[model samples]
Target: MKKYCAYVLLGLAVISNAALAKEAPLVSIPTHDAFFNAIKAHCGKAFQGKVSKDNVGNTFGNAKLVMHVRKCTDSEIQIPFHVGDDASRTWILAKTGAGLMLKHDHRNEDGSFHSSTMYGGHTVDEGFPQVQSFPADVYSKALFIESGIAASTDNVWQMMIYPSRFSYRLIRPAREVQVDFDLENPIATPSAPWGYE
Candidate 1:
């Protein structure tokens, strides 16, 4: 009789747990697909940008900043970031199945890879459709440490796309840089990025 009672109680507990699990609500979070589509919507265009904020210093002071959505594929988008006459930087956004990845491809005037190139991060969460943030990933941290810029190990890059504006931002412990582009006004597409031409 005692064994029967214990078995009944265990069955009841299992049923109650299953009931509770079924009653749990579903959560909906913004996805990388949405964010990627948001930026992909502006492909094949060029826009002018300005240094909106730079607490570290005016590294791009007064330079004519431009961003061109140069190439787009099903799984990747490459945007060349032009600062004045220098066109050695490209922002590559690619879908990693699990999430999105952001990589900075830097090249020299002769189309050679820079010492600190191809360093970026991957999204670790369901960021919003208009914005996605990527914290420094393992590769980026190691690259920073090896390149003697260990302070960049904590870098977090963010990209925001809206109807009229798009922003690229970099955040670290003591550094913050942002550039906002005017999407409302499309500019002539600049020359291809280094090694991309």
Candidate 2:
């Protein structure tokens, strides 16, 4: 009877070990998001510009945004300088049945709040501008305020493109802000011209 009990316990332990070995690693995805794989899929370069607004209830500025995509892994991108101050890493976590997204932990310098309507769209097909409308993967209202630099997202992230690069501007919604940069030939080393972070 003692020998039989020992065999049963051994079998149970082996089964438990096997189960644990077969588990997959955890993938992080925030509950709410703002942008998706919009710029990456459409624009083949990093966005290095700014979006600002001005008088008469109108606002606009030079918008510089840089996003890169890494295959089979999370993105390591630099928004550079979106708001007023150094750049902050906004984690756009990986998701299933969807693409890249922006993590919503809104905090900036001076303890102020900034909320914007975020949308993500990409050019799935390449032929002409009148080919087909891009599918907006995700959208959200995001607020980025003041927080310590070390308090950013603590997870692996990915950009929207492989070797990502492009720049654009909102220039106050309902208008197209100009983007000026070398889409074909980007600098050998990525740079933060606006000096965000």
Candidate 3:
């Protein structure tokens, strides 16, 4: 088992709040398909409310999760290569009969890649960590408290993914706050980031 290191975020604040409360393109209703990178372009200005925390304090603050879609001979996936000051993590995406899912190729602080699938499933609980399946591994209950989004009662599922490694705890689908971050890069990614041969 290869141990992949983890990633962390940098800072927060600054930049007008204009794009703060924006919302990413809603996950289109899908059931099964190849990977797509154009969705990565969706990284621009979007997200509703502010990000608060994720995976303890591993991935928070202002960071962008820039990603692009690519296809392989046997599979299609999304490669989200996040650049942060402390840590960075990547994600691989695929579509199944259930919906869009990440492969769970994350690394541990001790530098060990995931032994099993951290992502990929329909109802989330199907996977090991569970608590996900909606927006991939971006917002898992384990990830939320792990990163630093433990401030409010908002769950990690309502977090945003770009312009800043931030997550939001939705109070009423209208009220939220930017999340936190860890201190490691390449922390985890079900799939893989770009340029990882």
User: Quick one: best TM-score, which candidate?
Assistant: 1
Model 1 Cα shift for residue 169 (angstroms): 0.5
Could you tell me the lDDT of residue 1 within candidate 1? 100
- Please report the TM-score between candidate 3 and the true structure: 0.34
- Cα error, candidate 2, residue 4 (Å): 3.6
Q: What's the lDDT for residue 30 in model 3?
A: 27
Please give the TM-score that candidate 2 achieves against the real structure.
0.34
lDDT of 1 at 59: 83
Give one digit per residue, the lDDT tens place, for model 1 in 10-65. Answer: 99999999998773332334477777877888899999999888997888978899
Backbone N/Cα/C clashes per model: 0, 38, 67
Which residue pairs clash within candidate 1? Answer: none
Model 1 scores worst on lDDT over the 10 consecutive residues at 22-31
TM-score of each: 0.83, 0.34, 0.34
lDDT of 2: 0.34
Q: What order do you get sorting by TM-score, best first?
A: 1, 3, 2
> TM-score for model 1?
0.83
User: Between prediction 2 and prediction 3, which has the larger TM-score?
Assistant: 3
Query: How many backbone overlaps does candidate 1 show?
Result: 0
Q: Which stretches of candidate 3 lie over 4 Å from their true place?
A: 1-59, 62-65, 68-75, 85-88, 108-111, 114-195
For model 1, state the Cα shift of residue 77 in Å: 0.3
Candidate 2 — which residues are off by over 4 angstroms?
A: 25-46, 50-63, 68-85, 95-197
